[model samples]
Target: MDATELQAISDTLMRIVTPDMTPKQLIKAARKEHPNASKRDIARAAFFSIIANADQDHGKAKNLQAFAIAERTQNGAE
Candidate 1:
């Protein structure tokens, strides 16, 4: 995808994912628009978000990781 297409996909993802949404939720929502996007693609998108959040604020990565762990525990996710 081009830069414009990527930005549009990112924007669509952001709209679907909220603070309360889990990674699984975000991926599921992303799949609705990008059915052919691979698991690695979804992971890369999430990772980019993680990096961006980390860059915006120190310790954000750790916090997000911790949150992800807790979310996985709560959801019984592997």
Candidate 2:
């Protein structure tokens, strides 16, 4: 695959592994914690991380998304 395709795949995989972090939060946290790393690179890593932990159910993604949305709503109310 070309660099772009490979990067896209990498990003998706990372997200699958890190089911806890929303894509937006992952980008922000990665930038702050790894200042030298490109947001795109960090995102790709996170995606790969998720893929590594994936299962047939994808239950993790569903649960994480629900939790993230609820957290955002809770924080917004404060």
Candidate 3:
């Protein structure tokens, strides 16, 4: 997806994200509003959110950054 779509997804994520939520949980939440949003799309949104909202919430940004990294790595994920 392009930057605009990523931005919109990121905005949605920022609204729905909770402190204890996992990446999987975040994706499921995001998909509620964006039915066609892929895992990759959500992950990309996490990354974008991290950058755009870095100065807003440190904890939230950190969580999103972790999610983005998890998406790109193998880490024996199932």
Candidate 4:
């Protein structure tokens, strides 16, 4: 997707996400909201949203890190 679409997806995910929710939960919710989006796209949006939140609040950094690790592991990335 393009930057605008990515940002829109990220914004939607940010609205639906909660601090207590896991990355898988977030992806499921995002998929429900955006049925046409690819799983990779949803994860990328979540990553960007979490990173942006981390930039504004350092407390979110751990969530971002955890999500990143989970995403990489799920994708079979090293």
Best candidate (score: lDDT): 3
- Once model 2 is optimally superposed onto the true structure by TM-score, how far is the C-alpha of residue 51 displaced, in angstroms? 1.9
Every candidate's CA RMSD: 5.6, 7.7, 2.1, 2.6
What TM-score would each prediction reach against the true structure?
A: 0.50, 0.37, 0.86, 0.71
Worst 10 residues of 4 by lDDT: 57-66
lDDT of 2 at 59: 67
Residues 7-52 of candidate 1 have per-residue lDDT tens digits of 4555555455556666677667878998876544555454454555
Tens-place lDDT per residue, model 2, 14-75, is: 34435565656655654554455654454444344345544643665454444445545655
| Residue 25 accuracy (lDDT) in model 3 | 91
Put down candidate 4 lDDT per residue, 9-64, tens digits, no spaces: 88777677656879877677877877788867877876787777766755555554
lDDT computed for candidate 1: 0.56
Judged by TM-score relative to the true structure, which candidate is superior, 1 or 2? 1
Compose the digit string of candidate 3's lDDT tens values, residues 24-73.
89888999998998888888898889989989998888888888898878
| Residue 76 displacement (Å), model 2 | 31
lDDT of each: 0.56, 0.49, 0.86, 0.72
Candidate 3 lands at a TM-score of 0.86
Model 2: CA > 4 A from native: 1-22, 56-78
Candidate closest to the true structure, highest TM-score: 3
